[model samples]
Target: ARNAGIERATSEWIAFLDSDDYYWPEGLSTLRLVATLTGASIVCGMLSDADPGRLVPEELQVSIADQFLAVMAFRGVVPPLSMSSSAIRRDVVDTVGTFSRSHGTAEDREFWIRAAARFPVGIAFRPVAHYRIDHGHGKNDAHFASGAKLYVLRRIFREVIQNPVVEARLRSDPASDVFYRLHQSHLLCLDAAIRIRAGEMISAASTLSDAAVLCHTADELYCLIRELAYFLTFPRSDPYAATLRCSRWLVTLARETARSGDRRLTDALLVRASDAIYYTARQLRRSCGEQLAWRTVIAGLRVVPTIRSAKSFLRFLAESPRHTGHSLMYPRNQRG
Candidate 1:
């Protein structure tokens, strides 16, 4: 229906805005100027959350490969550009084809990836739209279930793998292999997150371990660690067991990083491992008593890092009480 509407329109350029999103007053003019200046088939602009922001660059051009890498690196939480913030040349659409309805939830993202593979894309580092986050009432409502989201994400990646242009680009670039692995790891981690939410702790842990094996870079490792933290802290039965497993992984990863000569990252991992153990101890203390919590921490210190002093242990002991009973590891209100 959307494609048919675009086809029937008489305009030389087309811009898309979702029903819940709105465009800035000068959005059309800005995109038109960018398209003309860069001779690009598609032009996208920066988006504001619910407020207008200043324009920094008049126009900027980004290669399709860079865009693809960025999306993969961020695990699709951040798209290369939002559909509502983009404008397309009519001719380019005629050549590259229209959006696919078969893609389920992420049809717009699929179309953008395909278009990017075939055309030059320009970006205006200026607000052209406001992406209204609809809180719990949005498409991402928890009632939808995470498994459905995982299926949609998997389907999108399968389409990417089948795309000739994207495959050809991957073949030409050796570094693309690493990016592809990271993308795969990200998908697995996402699946694990969903499983964790569903209280499938064993399955989630298995999937997360698989993702950890595929991680080769510091960024990938760090992201995996963060996801593990979230899983441990997520509201679930036997969260203490999950925390123990996560702390073990962190210690193992820290050892690996230390051997690889990344002392800074190793130190960070060790600190997080300690935190995880301390969090577990705090939980035990609340249910049982201070003696058991101290015992748990002392036992954990033997496997991971030892606390420098009793004061530091007391500090760790003090911190987790404040954050007890929270399901989310990170702030829910923060945008991806």
Candidate 2:
């Protein structure tokens, strides 16, 4: 395959393209600019799913250390096979070797992993390619497989251990490692609950037990306990009733926290409480046969002055991130 391509190629640079893919106008120009400025051997660009689309922009690291850390922190997760989105120097390929055909499902991801480790990689932040997201004929499952998340976590653990740059950073900020592990564990728990909701109780319990191992702090434990309570009562109770009860609990908690006179805490709690109510309203809107806009929710909120510490919480909640992405199971897990 390499010989065939090399014989026909006349260009100084080479880029990849799969049968069904194509590039945007600005993509190659962005890659060319980066290569010219940095003398980079490889350039990675952004890719969008052929259907719904990507959640984040194409990310790059200023240094190998930063790259290593980000990849490790997020676990050894790789993007989909859309290597054609990137452009590479022909000389770089000559030195590093051609792509491997061995990977059955994730060939492109494997290629980039090797490339980034071997050479200076420039990034073009512009979205370039359209990727075909196979839906498996409407039996589409977006959640990670049984052990896939854990598998990636373990791989990231190994990579960081091997990379001196990442190891030093972890040693310098030991809490960061704890924080990552805590998040990984929390996701595992959330996945378990979602599986249970999808009718996989045995798997849920097994996964939750594994997640319990990652719990390190009382706050972490508290979050899991609350989630457990919610899940346990979820099936038996009406969804609206559950949402209302949870909203009331959150509101009471925020009110009590506000009474303590800690301005930041008061605002934070209020924002969280209001956001919870807002989300519940969204879920209930369809079930209750009513549609709501953000403006409506805000208009209906009790009057609270933005100038006051507690009042800011309500305002913050009103402007909180919404329709941004899927909400993780335990909102508290978002913070350290």
Candidate 3:
């Protein structure tokens, strides 16, 4: 239906807006001005979640040298350039083709990936669109469920990773290696989350290990560790099993980071893994009052850097007595 509309439209430039989202009064004008000035095939404007309550800023055009990297950084979780917030030169669409129904709910994402890969993408840093957060159960909500989200992510990964054009582009540039790793890591994390939610503990652990290998930055490693903690701590099935799997993966990841000579990341992973073990043990004690010896937990704690250990000790002391009871009750298992 959207493709048909695009085909029939007479305009040289195209913009889209769904029924649930709206553009600010000046959105079209701002986009047109940006496209005119930058000559970019695609122009994206700043998107806001709520009303600006003030006049939109003057259009500030910025060139995106690496469209894939720029879009990945800008969009984060959401699709890059929501339909309501971007305008595209018609010829680019004609050349790259329109949205594909086969990609399912990730059509916008796939389209943006193709467009960005093929042409320059410009940003207009003025709030030109407001993407309303719908509370109702809509089509989008259904697509956000575990099965649907996983399917979309897998499709996106296959499309981006398997595309010969993207592969060639990355191989041509030495600086693109990090970005490629970052992209792969991001997809692996998403896949791992879905697997964890489905109670595929071992598979999740393996996927996370792959993600950890690609993580060069502390921030990336920390984010991945936090996701692991969240899913393992709040497992849908067996929390103990989830925690055990996560603890093992984190210990392995810590060793890898240490080998990479990233002390901060290594320490952070150790701290996170220890916390997972500590919480899991506490949960076990509370639920079954059964003491389980874990060599992995001790190994993680034994390797914690001195500075990180001091911080962990201070944090533990600040917690309530009930929170610290589990650690104190159990004989600390010693291993490295």
| Of candidates 2 and 1, the better by TM-score | 1
What's the true lDDT of residue 151 in model 2?
A: 36
lDDT of each: 0.62, 0.47, 0.63
Candidate 1, position 56, lDDT: 48
Q: 1-336, model 3: which lDDT tens digit per residue? A: 779879898988889887766788888888888787788888888776545553446646555444765444322332247678888889877777888887567688777776776677777777788755332335654565435755675667666756655666667767676777777776787787677667675576566667877877666676666655543342323445556666665666567656657566567767787676565544443333333423323333554434554554445435424445555434455321
lDDT of 1 at 16: 82
Pairs of residues clashing in candidate 3 = none
54-90: candidate 2 lDDT, tens digit per residue = 2344453321122322222233212321466767777
For model 1, the stretches where C-alpha displacement exceeds 4 angstroms are 53-65, 73-79, 134-146, 220-336
* Candidate 3 error regions (>4 Å): 54-64, 72-80, 135-137, 164-168, 200-206, 219-336
TM-score of 3: 0.62
Residue-wise C-alpha lDDT for candidate 1, range 130-157, written one tens digit per residue:
7553322245432234346456756676
- Which prediction has the highest TM-score against the true structure? 3
Name the better of 1 and 3 by TM-score: 3
Q: Which candidate leads in lDDT?
A: 3
